[model samples]
Target: MAKIAVVAANGKAAKKIITEAVNRGFEVTAFGRRAENDTDAKNYIQKDIFDLTREDLKGYDAVVDAFGAWTAETLPLHSKTTQHLADILSGTDVRLLVVGGAGSLYVNPEHTIQVADGENFPEAFKPLAQAMAAALSELRKRKDVKWTYISPAADFQAEGERSGKYILAGEEFTLNPAGESVISYADYAIAMVDEIESGKHIQERISVVGA
Candidate 1:
């Protein structure tokens, strides 16, 4: 069985991922700030994310980073927490799978512009977007760590339906057949668990949209 660790396991996305991985029979350990009474995973690690060390994560095949920060002060924690995990997992065999932001995905084929740079992007979300973008940027520089950044579509919905269907794409942003860029937290979880089992996009960033 694949031994997996999910950070910030109480979050909507992480909870869905935990449920999916557990239902698939993967040995999943959930890491969160507090113990979850209703967590799907049997194993749990209740501790501050930054306080976690490599020894705490030893023997896992992959670690899913579902950490999130939306405020001006907390937004920087996105990159900080990613760097912390990268440092701890450096030179290890464990794969670092990050729950990335779509804002950083390229808007054009030339890769010169990102979704966050677009005028249509919301001003309120730019700080969080830039922080996540920075995290992906710094993560790419670490050749020693095995990392895969997965960006969800522009209209990521927590309450959206889980058709268990999605289109996985490369760096450039993409839309589905209906001309929509959207995905549910449940569907995105399917992609994350699939990646964990397949390991097809190591050291690369991939995006997912509803199919």
Candidate 2:
């Protein structure tokens, strides 16, 4: 059985992914910040992903990095943790597959479709978005750990039904009209687990959207 570790498995998406992966016979260790809300996974390890050591990160075939938040202040959480994980998992064969923000996805004319409306979207949101972009900049500098950064749908969130259908693209990516790339937390989990099993798209960024 493949051993998998889901860092920051606290969200609906992470919970659903761990659940589905466990049902598929994968030995999953769902790690989260708090132990109180850990009934989501079959077996949960309560720990902060940022402080995870090599010993803690070892023995896992791959890591699904669902450790990020969408806010005006804690925008750099994902990338900072990514830096930490990169250090821990470096010089080893452990792979890091992360759930990234869609702000970095390509828009027309090579611009990213950031959450920028000047006023409606808080100034706070831009920094975190830019921080994630900076985090990706750092990720590209590494040649050690096999990294695959996956972006969420434009409408990827707590809402929406589990259609189990979405589109996957590499590098430059985006959504269509009426949020064509929307995928529920369940389907996003499914896609992440699927990617982990296949071990494809190493050291690259991919985006997903619903049909």
Candidate 3:
């Protein structure tokens, strides 16, 4: 069984992931600040990721972070929590899959969609956005530990179905099969879990979208 740990597993999509993972017969562990609703599996655990020590990561084959800067207001906590996760993971042989912001994904050789010069990207949100970018930057240089930073389309929100199909790529690449870009949170999770199981992508940043 694939032993996986999902940090901040109380989020909407995360609940689906845990459900699907358990149904698919994988050993799933979810750690978060608050208790999740319920699960058939006894893998749910309550703990602040920031409180996790290096030993905390010993058992999982992969760590999926659905945790994002909640409100633009929580970037400080976001940065701190994220950095702590990255730091702890960096010390181990485990894989890291933290979601990045679309703002940093490049639209052209000279510019990125997240922040354009003189353009506003959520100011309060930028800190964690920046944190994701910085984290990906550091992860890119590591030869050990598989890394995959994912971003949703511009239309990403709490909607869609678990169709189990989407796109994947690294920096400077965009996966938009519809001519325009968009993906359901469900489809994104399907792709997310698929990657966790397949181990096809290692040390890359990709965006998820539908056709």
TM-score against truth, every candidate: 0.98, 0.86, 0.82
Number of the top-ranking candidate, with TM-score as the measure: 1
Q: What is the C-alpha lDDT of each candidate?
A: 0.94, 0.77, 0.70
TM-score of 2: 0.86
Cα deviation at 211, candidate 1, in Å, is 0.3
- Per-residue lDDT tens digits for candidate 1, residues 142-190, read 9999999999999999999989899999999999999999999999999
For candidate 3, the 10 contiguous residues with the lowest summed lDDT are 111-120
- Candidate 2 or 3, higher TM-score? 2
Better of 1 and 2 by lDDT: 1
**Per-residue lDDT value at 194 in model 3:** 80
Residues 125-211 of candidate 2: C-alpha lDDT, one tens digit per residue: 677667777787788888988888887775676766778777776655556556565777777877887888888888888877776
* Best prediction by lDDT: 1
Clashes of each: 0, 2, 1
Estimate, for each residue in 1-211, the C-alpha lDDT of model 3 and write its tens digit.
8888888888776766677677778898888787654544467778988788778888788888777665656655555665677778785768888766665677667545443222655565556567666666666676655678777765666767656667765555365755656677777777777878887777777777765
Clashes of 3: 1
Cα error, residue 130 of model 3, in Å, equals 4.0
Clashing pairs in 2: 181-209, 181-210
How big is the positional error of residue 61 in model 2, measured in Å on the Cα after superposition?
A: 0.6
Error of 3 at 7 (Å): 0.6
